[model samples]
Target: MAYWLFKTEPDTFSIDTLRLQKVACWEGVRNYQARNMLRDEIKLGDEVLIYHSSCKKIGVAGIARVVKEAYPDHFQFDPDSPYFDIKADPSNPRWMMVDIEFVRKFERIVTLAELKAIPDLENMPLVKRGNRLSVMPVSEDEWQTILHQE
Candidate 1:
């Protein structure tokens, strides 16, 4: 039961989209570090904090649960897909994705400003400068602290 933060651009794939769809494949991760986390660390039944990034009201928007474990990201194999990788081989995948089911949408966002102001969350990667891995781990204490803001 690990905790994680998954960043998404609200316009690209918002919490609202997840809420509507119920379950969605978390794809388009290009970073090796983030890809590795999705492929190796994140697992079924894990909880996730849906963080809205690169948006006007950037913040933690909601919660989701990993309903399916990591598997090869099919988009990487499709030439028509923006995430397609020419170097990716079908026999050996270069990327992975997981299915996350919508859990809860917070009544209001827990703004980045508010998170940065929390002394206990100072160590969180999301609040740190230049630390932009889209998929990152969250400590139990940090998870509770962020949810407390909701």
Candidate 2:
């Protein structure tokens, strides 16, 4: 199964929220590249690193698994929702989402600062300058390395 990292603002949708919901539709991705990843790359049973971004201390907070494949994000059809898009239609959707099931929260947050200091992680997209994609693919080697790091 493919590995991935999905970032969410803690204030908006934290790891705690996922723990409570058990499963949730990962919606509101606006970037074309990120949307494409969800649409084409992710598959059922894929592992995902649930990351907390755009917060005081950014890090990988927990683990999740893809439970549903790509589908139109319903939030785009809701006019009252902050993620709504008038341009998207039910037939030809401009946005897509996937369902993820919470796995486990890390004992300690693997902070971005800590990740940056790892030589092997220097090439990671998360540590690169100006890199802001919320959903990104993670290499198997990189995935194993990060998970084993203290």
Candidate 3:
């Protein structure tokens, strides 16, 4: 199965929230690249690292598993939704989403600084400057490296 890193604003959709909700639809991805990953790449049974971004304490907060395959994001059709798309047709959607179930929160967050320090992890997209794609592919080695880090 492919590995992935999914970035989120902790304040908006924290690992704690995922734990509480058990499973939730991962939506509101507006970036074309990220949206494409959701629509075409991410699949059921894929492992996702939940990275907390746009917060003071940015890091990998937990793990998750894709429980459902990609499907049209219903929010795209609702005018009241923040992610509403006027150009998106119901018959042919412009946005898609997947359901991820909570796995387990990390005992300690793997800070970005720590990620940057690791020689093997230096090539990871998360450690690269200005790389902000929310849904990104992760090499299996990189995935295991981060998981095994203290």
All models: lDDT? 0.97, 0.92, 0.93
- For 54-121, candidate 2 gives per-residue lDDT tens digits of 88888999899999999999999999999999898898999999999999999988999888898998
TM-score of each: 0.99, 0.97, 0.97
Off by over 4 Å in 2: none
Best by lDDT: 1
Give lDDT tens digits, candidate 1, residues 1-150: 999999999999999999999999999999999999999999899999999999899999999999999999999999999999999999999999999999999999999999999999999999999996899999999999999999
Return the lDDT, model 2, position 26. 98
lDDT score of residue 100 within candidate 2: 98
Model 1 per-residue lDDT at 50: 98
Clashes of each: 0, 0, 0
How big is the positional error of residue 141 in model 2, measured in Å on the Cα after superposition? Answer: 1.0
User: What lDDT tens digits, residue by residue, belong to model 3 across residues 47-139?
Assistant: 999999889888899999999999999999999999999999998999999999999999989999899999998888889999859999999
- Residue ranges of candidate 3 with Cα displaced over 4 Å: none
Candidate 1 off by > 4 Å: none
